[model samples]
Target: MEEDTDFRIRFSSLCFITDHVGFHGTIKSSPSDFVVIEIDEQGQLVNKASDEPIYKVNKMLPEPNNLAKKTKLDRQNLSFEERSNQELSTLAGCSDGDQIHAPGSEKEDTIKDGTSEGEEGNIDVLGSLLDEKTDELLSQFACDVKERWDSKTELIGPSPEFSLGRILDKNQRTILHSAIRQKFPFLVTIGKNSEIVVKPNLEYKELCHLVSEEEAFEFFKYLDAKKENSKFTFKPDVNKDHRKAIHHFINKKFGNLVETKSFPEPNYSADNPSVVITVRFREKAHKHRKRSLLECQERKVIYTAFTLRKENLEMFEAVGFLAIKLGVIPSDFSYAGLKDKKAITYQTMVVRKVTPERLKNIEKEIEKKRMNVFNIRSVDDSLRLGQLKGNHFDIVIRNLKNQINDSANLRERILEAVENVKNKGFVNYYGPQRFGMGRKVHTDQIGLALLKSEMVKAVKLFLTPEDLDDPVNRAKKYFLQTEDAKGTLSLMPEFKVRERALLESLHRFGMTEEGCIQAWFSFPHSMRIFYVHAYSSKIWNEAVSYRLVTYGSEVVEGDLVCLDEDIDDEHLPSSKVHLVTEEEESANTYAIRQVVLPVLGYNIQYPKNKVGKWYQEVLNRDGLQTCRFKIPTLKLNIPGCYRKILKHPCNLSYQLIEDHDIDVMKEGSYIDEATLSLLISFDLDASCYATVCLREIMKHDF
Candidate 1:
């Protein structure tokens, strides 16, 4: 065959490992011509065949009780003192003397009547400040908080704040604080400048630790110095035992951010020192720290896992259609990886919060859409990308007579190619799908623009016309000429989702630099990352080609090799590899097939040889530095990984079929009666592109 000069080959690599003559043929002539079966991490084939029953809700795991709703109902039925004692018991994990008193309770009435042992001289001096109207308003506020607490329904406006007129005497202020705490323990009272203010308590208690009032005050002062928000406060005075109980309550209810500490009153002459406790932020507290204990308790099997078989449908398109039918967003669905759009593929899929019955009911609609789902079951965890072991391919290459002389020649060529692959393997270069097919502007170009922090250029490259006559192309051309996003959007088809989204965002946000960047970001995270990953793949392909040309099939001194021979998955990150040392290479510990090349990223180590220097040359040619991998503005951090230089397909096999033996060929079809076809079947590790393998076998541009 003449030297291939395709742009994709130049962009990636044109190197082929095997020297055997490759026969020409066409693959994916029909949807049935290509087949893919996903293999799960357990080494089990994820195919359409399943013995599991049709999804039913009864077959799912039982759900836990709704504790929040039950608690809300119980709180509504309890009296003020009963509720306080109950909450204290449940939250503090204690009872008895820990109970808080309500107003008019025996303890409070005794203090009010000047009949208590220690408070005989104390009287209700602040009685004039507490009018019946004030008491009613405070009670109403408490009721509102109670009703909305469990459900987290937003309270209208801000929390209600009650202001008490200045009381000159400390004893009178203390009396008022005690009265409020006894009546509404959920409310917090703050005393400043002889004035008292009361509001509903909304404190956090994560990582609680005791600190003195002075320490708490100093921490707030430090925050003021740094101009940070002081999200902490001191609580009203309480007895020593009550302070300890309050600490437990704060820890259990608020989760450790807020802490309680009791200290002696300054310059007190009494035999027993008065105790004052304060709640304040920890020294370096995070506002939204994850609590593993709470997460474990809340985790449940709310996701449904099933196998989906799709024909001639893109993964995203299939997922989007299912999401619409299931009344859920596309984000609710998760899969191991994307499959070929033109092939019949069977892969595992997961959907969150959808019942098995709901999934089963959509079977008819799914079948109408040329898709099948089976083996539905409830799983605690959702399927994640790169979770599969590999994929099994059953591909048919037809029309081999156009290149081969006869059936014998085709069979001999295919057998030689398969055998060569089984032994020497083929270069693991990225396929055309990574850069997109038949597009004027490749995805890698946009990725390069993004890495350069040229958002406008990236956006323009993305919107560049792929064809001169297609409706989507026309719309893109119109926008490029006039920059009228609204007008262009009207001409764009709804099926062109990413294009429509970019136009919609631009129409709303205008066509400024920030707007263009925002429009670029409007694409889904996977779509955005795919472009950058494509660029990385391109560089990786060229590097692998260079390594092969410079060092042939030799295990070089500075090459990186996989440390674990048992690691069947090639999709593992760079952490699995290490540089081959002189000692290891001398001992022949690692083979050339075990060598790995770096994907361009910030978090990877390049080869320690001249091949590493070649990477820098490639990056410089593309106007990129390693620092560009860490784009903080776009939040695009590419942690570069490693991929093996070559891959040997597992269970490789092939057969030559004549036109008469082909079931799909019709009697009066235009195809030649003596046409030869090759049936190829093989298994590849995760992240290995099957099309690249086919390229090695056929030496044809797809």
Candidate 2:
């Protein structure tokens, strides 16, 4: 009898309770009308003369047929803060007494004698009982971010541009799901009180279609449900938090690509005795670990790790300058890959026969250059590009407000995001690092200009500083823009060595446009190659985006599939992409494990289908042809290469740490008191980026 009575009470409440009851006018509610109250961040309720928590009486509407009716009043009086414009629009065309069907309710035809057939309607369902204001805030925030990134991409970058919606969807699927499931995608130990338990309402999806405007509405409610149930308190709208986390992840990871060169495996004669053979993957079932002895002498290679703190220089530039200071040429120095200057990057570098004393002095000199060498050791071989197995990154992301203080629910939500990423990894489009992070001018743009023989434009864009905030660089850029090449040479700063060299060449050749072209070629071979590579990388990124959106992970006929995982090595400066044959294409027995796309070059043979058509279309849209990649003027006959359609970071790990843990004081950086941060660490194979891993985590497009 008691259970029956409880059910009756619940059923009665459900019939009358609507999540967003429209108010007739601007009248505010007294504290007596609300059963419970919570304060907003501004600590204001009703602004006229309010000190107490003024509540809005959820003005209940009378039920008409299945739909609720708003009180007779002009909606024109409604303020932005109190308006539900979308909801109001749904109630249009219905007269005062006409029958109306509520959202998720069965049509009159579908319902017979007050009983619906098939699944029951979701009217007044538990999942629908979310705070409308919070839902609106979250959704609006998400939409704004998506629109912003999309607009920015349309202006300066390649087409098939970055999609903020797709990124958010990916993040929601990967990171968020993992966190909620309490399962890390890659294995790791959990921190204290990291998990939050909650029951999800599975019936919500059937009730109504999630609209584009309400992209984040359901997520906000999902978090709100826990708060209402007193399971744990978390902010209903985490838009700010989401943005910070996304941008932070982007700045740290997805901002760069690691380009390397391919070389043959080391060969040694059997007579040599100093070399030892090591098994890469040993079986645990074996009685004893097996090993093979190889004959070779250890090369004098000094492996050193350095942290770059400034953003003004690229990795190769810093290493080259360091070599010059050490009285040796840059050719004497070798490194696995270049690290990003925009970050506090720690990476390995190798130099032969450099004494410990000299290396220590070099380290001290680097400190003056806003860099620090933290580790140095002797290795048996020279560290060629892509020699290292992978890079392990420990990144500290700051200024996230959503998860600040005791926001356990926010943390739980983040964990959920992380969980989503763990199950199915993200699409690995090359980050902004593959192309330079210039606002008006990108490296790929300059490269494309070079390919099209737009030397004057390329030279101008190159001299135009990416960071306009720097007055010195900005002034120098202005001089280059307003003055002739001859005059600009005198105005160029001493540090603007590349720009000065180009200007000098122009002046030397009578300030003619041909001199500008020759001047561009005079830069370091490493730097010149980078521009062409950037163009190729951009094509690869765009192709990957198109492939994932159209065909997804499934393989189709005429698709150029990669036969081996090692196909990524073909991306090396010296190699090219090799697609499977028609016989292989005919055999559909193999799983669609890897799809590789080609970077444009004369040697590139595009897939003979929609994929190939897309490649031609993209090139055509850029007003160029694949043959242009073999330009004689630039001497850049960059061969086509392959990039894996998807990348999953290996050994991924992350933890949300306190701001106090970061040493911002050393750099005189001031962190917001309300900010929360994350310390994410992960490892990626050579040429695979840590930023890509972060993209999987945060899902922010730009």
Candidate 3:
């Protein structure tokens, strides 16, 4: 009843009541006629009328079938009732003009005789019933996010391509049903009441058909694109959040040809073997006593406990939501951020620490096999959201260019870059997710509009429900629109009127006070913090200084270069893409480096001829001890003295080796010239045995 308070009649009808006097002599009627037209909640017709209900007068239409010529006085009004929809489904028929039956009643045509029958009627009835049920279900629906999947091979970095798949949620199922149902095939989630809810009136099949591969991208909303100066690189859309997908995708294409390398078990001998659990599962007899909360203390025994994967966060949230639906209060639980579905992830969840019977009952609801326990143990308390800090990313890169120019140099550069980032810092730019790619611009625009609307509401409206064209609404809308362009146009009225006025006002009175006012208002986090922060400064400064011209990648032809030299607007394909030359393709690369050995100062012997401080020190301290003790010289002619070589995927090696007399060492070794000649001389204190691969490129065209 309380819920129905908000429900009002949507359709109107008239109830006719006739009052006739049976006169034998003369037929006479009242001179004036009176009628009453119904009013809505506020006693107004569509809220346009005055507060008072209006009365009307008009001649009444006589009932056609009544030969007595009886005039009808009708009251127009909206009718409604509070009743369960269950009765509507049970209904087998509706009044067909006061039970007027077809001439085929005797033929037992119940449908024609105002009774629901036959396949057509049954189909209609079923459809209606389904419609009602669907509506009832949707009314109670909250929020639902879909888990996407891939069906074909996907290539990820460091691995060969492999196959992809997915698992969907119920709302996705609903969308699928709706799409496959009737006239329209798409089910769009519309924004309202600060939430995105699915549109109503879609049939089950209609919704179902909407579960499509291409259509799914429509769900991503748009956002405003930053200016050209900003480093807004696009991030590829990761379908389904499947972590192992890229590896699988890569493996598929080159799996048969590429030989598999043996992955031996780790050689670390654990010092703390006690941390390992000997028994993973326990039998019923060894389990603890348990009871369910729903039953009387003595009546209910704990059923059993089961483990869930702790890996996926969504699985945890799903299980939690499912448990709430099943009236089961999880006694114990633990999880990290929602893990990707379809991936074999591990998580921990516990039912009440009750007996086997009660646990069994709840465990029946735990449906997913992937969710069961890997190992069960007593954790101090249930693990909540974001308990884990980060993940260990393991990767493998394969199928690189065989003949890479300066492979050693390139490898060093990449390794150095990685080390540089790890040591110094990375650009604190936003990840490439702010822009919605793959999704059509319309979706992104809508999202941007929504964001702008919210910003306007927060900044301008604050709280109000006035006309959108009102000064307050207009002011809020002003903030929502983009603030670029040299001058406002005078063509259009709706938007131009405001723009032109604002432009004139700006010209006459200088910039709007709100710009400064808004800045001041946005200060705490937006002004003071952002202004003072190095990250913001870096972001803006880098934006101002974006450059990418390498030493020799220049063009001699007429080049329509942009103001920013590296970013030429007229360049073929545009600078947004990382364009590499055909030669560079044979040697595509990025780099990183790690210094395992810390530098401790230099160990310098008298260069045999130095006039520096060391020489001066020796001269002063030892009183010119010019005795040639041979400097304890080490002829140290070590033949075949090659340092240990460690192989890396990119095929480059580095090591510590003895600094030497280049001429003597070059002539001293007895190894083959080919391998021996490759050993370049290093004039450093530390030595290195570098294993280099002369990367060779081969392209096959059959």
TM-score of each: 0.63, 0.49, 0.20
Q: Model 1 over residues 1-702: C-alpha lDDT tens digits? A: 111122134533368888877777788998899999999877778885766523333335433333212222122122111123333232211122222222222232112322221212222322444777766676677677656754667668866667776777766665666555444444556555667676654431111234443443333232212222334444444465556555544543422233445666675446646666555433332234667854544444467889999999877778767865776545567788878888999999888757677789899988988999988877666777788988999999887743444345545676777788788888888777777766677777777778888888788878888657989889988988998998999999876656776786676557888777656655545566778888888778878888888988888789999876567433555678888888887888888878888888877888999899998887877777545587655556787777888888999877666657564433444544357687889999888888899888766667
Report the number of the highest-lDDT candidate. Answer: 1
Give model 2 RMSD, 1 decimal: 39.1
Error of 2 at 183 (Å): 88
Q: Residue 305 lDDT in model 2?
A: 30
- Write down the lDDT of every candidate, Cα atoms only: 0.66, 0.44, 0.23
**Per-residue lDDT for 484-531 in model 3, tens only?**
211322222332222333333232223344332221221111111111
Candidate 1 CA-lDDT value: 0.66
Ranked by TM-score, the better of candidates 1 and 2 is: 1
Preferred candidate (lDDT higher): 1 or 2: 1
What ranges in model 3 sit over 4 Å off? Answer: 1-334, 340-372, 376-384, 401-410, 428-702
- Residues 1-702 of candidate 2 have per-residue lDDT tens digits of 011121011111111101111111110022111111111223321112322312222112221221122211111111111112222222111111221211222122111111211112222221143246633443354354345543653323421111112222322222322232121111111111222112211112211122222432333232212222122112222243333332222211111111111122245334331222111111122233444422111211233332233333566667656655655434456665666555544444555445434666766767767655533444334445554455555565544434223343445455665555555555555556666543456778777777777787777667766555564465456656664665676555655545655665554444446656556644644566678777777777666666665665566666666656664444433233345555665665344446667777766677766778898887787778545576565555676666666566555676655556654232334445345566555555556655555545553322
TM-score of 1: 0.63
